[model samples]
Target: MSIIAVVTALALSIIPTGDTPTVSVQQGAVQGVQAEGVAAFKGIPYAAPPVGPLRWRPPQPVQPWSETRAADHVGAICIQPPANGDNAVGPGPMSEDCLTLNVFAPEGATEPLPVMFWVHGGGYVNGSGTADLYDGSNLARHGVVVVTINYRLGRHGFFDHPALAAERPAEEPAGNYGVMDMIAALKWVHANIGRFGGDASDVTIFGESAGGVAVSQLMLAPDARGLFAKAIIQSGVPQGATSRLDIATPSGPPLADRGASFAALKGVPADGTAEALRAIPAEAFLDPAPNFGGGDLVIADGRIVPTSIEDGFARGLQAPVPLIIGTNSNEFPWARADTHPMAQALTPEERTALIAAYDDADDFQGRFISDVMFNGPARWLARQHAARGHPVYLYSFDAWPDAMPQPHRGAWHAQERQYVFDTLSTSPWPTTARDEAVAKVASDYWATFARTGVPAAAGQPAWPALAEGHEEALVFHNDGVAVEAVPNAARLDLIAALLDRLKAAGLR
Candidate 1:
């Protein structure tokens, strides 16, 4: 049936159905579920599918339809593997018809709601906004319009070619299509959110892991200016994390050469790369033989992503907006150590040796992973925003064993998702009575931050704006909120220097 028909029928069915009053928007209408103080609409399409010839090009406006598209079900994820995290969500369906988003807002017939655009994290290769971890219901319950979006991923989204660019001189550089998708979503929000009771002027863009990197990089994109009023960076920093084809210079294997690699694959053709990749089964593409390790997809396209975010932020170039950021105390243990039971049970000798190898290294090897993977980037973001004379809040999730599920060494990568959303049942983290209380506190703070510029809460400790040298940030732990300076500051500084040099060398 036509989407118009579906929407009309849906609208007809909503004749005073208890609480959730079905509403209409420019494209069509939706009957959202309402509870407490929030009204939610899931699977809303903000842009047209960039399929066939439109592939690799910038996003276009949503198709003008006579009827509303049925957004009850999430749109298919960009043609990529499903999330296989420590909690692997098995492979599911795929489609080019994947540009869709979801939203939650406080129920009110009129007036604009503050916007919180959420970007999910999956290392830029795996994951979707449809995941349970990003449920915007509770957040909307806190009084802002919360949105989660799915963008292109992996080979389908990041493949770049000089031929492709030449074919479309009007377009941005090919890789970072996923990032372009996000900019498109923000634009969509800017254009149509008011009809849904959202304030386009108060948008706060935020995300975790790769998503955090996306928000950070978006700061550098000229096109993203003024789309958001604030930013909440989680675990990502834009450093050497560029698309293979997007790098202007490189020192890796022969494969790093854009000309050479494309020349070698010339027989295959560029536009057809997507088809070739699709022809290969999902499992095979998950990891190729020589193993480049899931193939990083967020390349440094010259157009949408003009420069590296790390350099951009450090040069006083990030979006001048209020910012909030931080990471769990021991996120690596989840990404690395948690995968191995024995590793988590590090013997005294192992712990000592591990600490020795890392304890003194500038920022330690683990610190590099933590910083690049999630922390330092966050700190850098907080600093840049504060420098902009905006109120920037920095935090550290130190809830440790009390917040995590299973015996954990400390706060792990995804451990905060559940807490921030007050969702512990679904996340893999160990949850205790303390965990529940902590999660409530965490979610409450995030909601309050998104609602107003302040992350204040009732009976909760006051979070202070970040001050340079005075690196004091909020530490959310079982002991309740406390103020603590960013630990290992000197070590992180050393790690940053080493990484700058290594990235300069391009892994040679």
Candidate 2:
């Protein structure tokens, strides 16, 4: 067939054939099969190869192809240290040429659908948009266009150097080249989503864990201001960024600090530390300590971040968009347990030290960790956003089937995230019926929000916002979804106040 005929046929296949349909795009095309009436396009490249000199630099626009590019298999993941256990290959030998994205769109999509750009979470050090748990297929079938992207990771994505900066003085960025890559993807979306039948206006950006933190940063970024409209942050970070002191903001304490800023990364050799960072292989830069944490996340790099995110938000500098945010019931539990070198059952003495931190009379050590990590921080932020009168919807995914074994990772961090993206098969959870049920419910709620800003799903219990102190908020409980007074409200409040006092005293 001629190129025009091939392109025309591909585009036509994307249209509905009564109940059957598909769609095509440039570079390649997708003839999507309908799942509840939505079409999904998988694994599309958004930028030029990050290989060669582009490895540590900001992403550049994708090279346009003469023929439609086929997007069937997932692109290779951004370099990420592999999962520590069973899956540990330490990001399994990555390439500098990894800048790909996936898309999901409504079937027979002619009009511009609302766009929901998602950034995945791997503590800014690990994770890929291709993790079976993040398939945007089912999500696109829900009447929106979902785009998940890959950016540089660890040293390959976030490295800093003085030579490169001096070389690109007209385009010098402080670091956080990964975050900048995300912004570039959004800009690409804004420029090209129309061709994919996606609406540029009324975009809703959302993510969990590190991805949520990325969304939070996007909200604070002056450069990212007009790129999105609404945002959903599932267990996002409002604070606790490391080595950001190295960033040189136009104002404020440069995002960089100590000897680790992008400037420091740049100054490593010039400042005489180059022998250490450069002498080592790039992959060696992945220290095990941050253990998928943001110790190496976006820095203050004087450019994109401009200043501390909290300071920026405090100064009313964040994008004023509707925000839907929440956390699972067991974030802190796994954070402590997983990051440790030795996974030992806590001894009585160890347990006491753990529970003592919370001043709790109960023996649930898990609760203490959970409280400190997510519950404490999440409740405070919900209230703060509520005070600002931003439409904030808070939820707690406390439900896990009783059948899942002991030392249960009930609704743990990144656990609910799989469900939200409708990628249950990607997870190794015990495949009990309860797991399936929870996954469906969670996916439904997520899709509902992507469809409408509110996370209301039918046949489930009514989920109220944390807006009023009067109305109960949604709780995904063992008893199925319920509306509660923000689970353990009093304890959460105490933790919040305690942290506040400690912060005021320069202690926390």
Candidate 3:
């Protein structure tokens, strides 16, 4: 049955039947569900499944469906490690045919609203857009369209090999299938979001952690230009995060070399064909021993990611759009108290200066790791973007919830997500009155940013944009929001200086 024929038949069958929202996209018509004043479309295939012969190739167009496909529930999540009681991939079963996205919009929308596209983070190895914590229904109620998408994960998403390269067109991308999936999804949204009352020209791409890293890469990607007008990166881009496609770097060997090693481990010859590599069962790659997609997930593949993020920013090559980049107060708890790797990079005098600045060795160790890995890099990126005369906002989230276990020191990585999405009700931790209040403010700020390019929440401190020398950040604490100097600036500056030295010497 052809799509035209299906549409003709559907019109005869009382198409759009009552209040169910049905949208016609390039592929075909899709019927969605409505709830709580929000119309949601889930499991909408933006591209064909990357299975069988299409295993590693860039996303291909989905075959046109002949009928109004039901998009009531999310599609299967991409293959990943089993969740340890954290349903990271949502309720859907795991499979390779997981390139689907969901959209949440006000059911009574009368005009095109700003679009907020969300990318999920899981170390580039796991996670899906279907997770309950990521539901955009509540966020959509704030006068914007919200979208969440699932890209390929693990080896299925980011693998490279000579055979795969040999078989592909010279211009096609390799080793960054996940990145390609994101671009494809964005293109789909640009073409189809208007049907859901979303302004395609006002799309703001945002994400947390690896998703945030993806947003940064997208800003650096030439293919991703003009696809979005704004970006928000949360705890992404630890300094020196990029890798090479075919050469060794201080971070790791070429991704192709790793792929060849994995192929050899799976009993394929070093010169194996792409067919043999794709023949290996997807589940076989899930074994923890091989670490198929581990290490340096983003690669400078020349076509997609042309250069390292820092270098791109330094060279003024990043997308000249509004930016919001930040990190958590305690991204990682440092266990080693006696010695820290950062100290090795410093001289005796520098170490003495750091010790004098921060008295407690154990506390310094933990904050040092967080600063070097997350906070410092965020500030540096914010500075670089701001230097380019772009509107840049930097924030540090330290909102510890009451439901958190005893001795709650500070907000941990990704904790701001619940507040950002106003989804505290989904948390296993009991939601307190203060938590709900913070969530309202947090979501308001995010949604407002998507609408106006400025983050403003009612009854909260106005979030300020970063300037060349003014290194201020909006602080989200347990009590409420406040504008303050970036915490740990002195330590972060020292670490940044050491990291610069290491990068110059190619030793980081």
Candidate 4:
């Protein structure tokens, strides 16, 4: 068959047959499938394909369709490096035209339910909403509508070339296209989620790792205001070493310069134009070589992200919504002692004294780095929000499930996701009665928060909001979930001081 005929056939196949569940979104009608008391609408386009001229630009409205479109199969995920043995990318076809989202709602729901929109994390380079780990079925069954999205990844999603910036209209923002895509998705939800048995006005945006960072960024994003009613950030905080939104220096060369540098290594020009860069295949930019000055993921273009997170919080510019933010017990055990910022900033005597205070000499470096990078920032954010009178619930995930091969690493980064999503059966680790019990409690907390802005479950202890004299966190452990005072107060203070010194020295 001709290419046109093939495309037509593929489009036609998406339309659901008689008796399938259907909903009318802003763009068009989508037919979903029902199973196990849940209605799931998959591969629903939220925006126009970001291909050709649309590449690197803010997401545009998806073209409306007339006929009922099939939303049964998963959509293609944004272009990303294939996962190694880790199954990091999960399961999904790869494509540039991947601006789609999935919605899961309880079947036979007559009233609109709270919405939980999730953003998956892959170091800002990989991960997709279609990942098996992000299945929203379990969450939807808890009387909440769940949604997940796929945005651009790697350089295709976040490039900052002078030529591209100059070519665009002066009013348009440059860089951070991935974040722009997310804003567009949220806007779509605000306009259309009601049709899927969801309360558009009661949406809670939650994400892990890079997704959590996006949540933090969205809190301060002017355009994202009113898009989400609440936010949950897990194992990701916008402070310490990863705080800077713009990896490129203001006076430094654009990311294209680094691309040119990489091209030069391959016998190409050292300075390439925007048109020249665009003409290259998308896969060329996917090379894992050190390009674009290394750290140019999210740029603070004064548009999407107006200012530093600290400055925004200090100025009371963050969204006044209830927040849930916390980190795992062991964030990164492979960290090296010499690589930590405090290692270079502090004198030998100070470093010795700090390690002695922690009393875990062998693992002090990893613990200290984890605190400075993740734990400290999380607590600081909670305090900032509480000081501003916004209710903030904090937690620490110390539960090591039987599935963890490296339990000694403690409750490692991103481990809370399974429990929060109640997806332990799909994970590699063996599940115990306690694991299932904890998963239910964790997932209940999330669903409850989405419904009422308070993280509470029926049998779980009362989780207090962080305040001046009431600094506490709901500790999620395998033995039992309980409320406790914030852990490692003095050590966190030391890490905070070290970070201050580093920032003062312009080393951050």
Regions more than 4 Å wrong, model 1: 1-20, 85-92, 170-173, 240-296, 334-368, 371-373, 400-408, 493-508
* Candidates' C-alpha lDDT: 0.66, 0.64, 0.83, 0.79
User: Model 1: per-residue lDDT, tens digit, 1-508?
Assistant: 3332233334333323335545566667766666676666777877788776666666777766666455555656666553546342222456667788887766642445678898877766677777667777776766677888988776556655544655556534565677889999999887667655677777889887777778888877888998998888776655544444534434343223442254334344434444443344434434432223223445555667766676677677777877888887767743442333333444466445544545553324334356445676667667777776878888888774443355445776766776776656666645678777887788778878876888887797788888766778889877688877786566456545545655475541
Q: How well does each candidate superpose onto the true structure, as a TM-score?
A: 0.81, 0.81, 0.93, 0.91
Candidate 2 per-residue C-alpha lDDT over 1-508 given as tens digits, one digit per residue, 9 for 90 to 100: 3342233334434354333333444444444344565555555777888665565567776766665455555667665665654221123335556677777666565455678898887777777776556777766666678888887776666655544444555766746878888898888777656555676665788888778878878888778988887888788767644335344433233322322443333335444443344444445444453232364456765568765656765666677777777888777553443333211334456445545654463424456656766676666666666677677778888866554556755776766765666655655544566666766787777767766777777699766766665746677765568777777777666556655655676554
Model 4 TM-score, all chains together: 0.91
Which tens-of-lDDT digit does each residue in 89-191 have in candidate 4? 6666678999999998776665567899998888778888987678899988888999999998888787755557568898998678888999999999887
In model 3, residue pairs whose N, Cα or C atoms come closer than 3 Å (at least 3 residues apart or on different chains), thus clashing, are: none
TM-score of 1: 0.81
Cα error, residue 164 of model 1, in Å, equals 1.7
Best by lDDT: 3
lDDT of 3 by residue, 1-508 (tens): 3342233333332323335788787899888888888888999999999999999999999999998899889999898888776635688688999999999877655556789999998888889999989899999999998999999988889988889988888878888899999999999998788777777778999998889988988998899998898999999864333567888866557888878888898888769999999899988778766684434666888778788887888888999999988999988764442455566767677767776666576567766666777888899889888988999999999886776775435677788888898998777678788988888888998999999999999888888899766778999888889999988888787777877877687656
Candidate 1: residue 394 lDDT (0-100)? 88
For model 4, the superposed segments whose C-alpha errors exceed 4 Å read 1-19, 240-256, 259-273, 291-295
Cα error of candidate 4 at position 267, Å: 7.7
If the candidates were sorted by their lDDT against the true structure, best first, what order would they fall in?
A: 3, 4, 1, 2
User: How many pairs of residues collide in each model?
Assistant: 8, 32, 0, 2
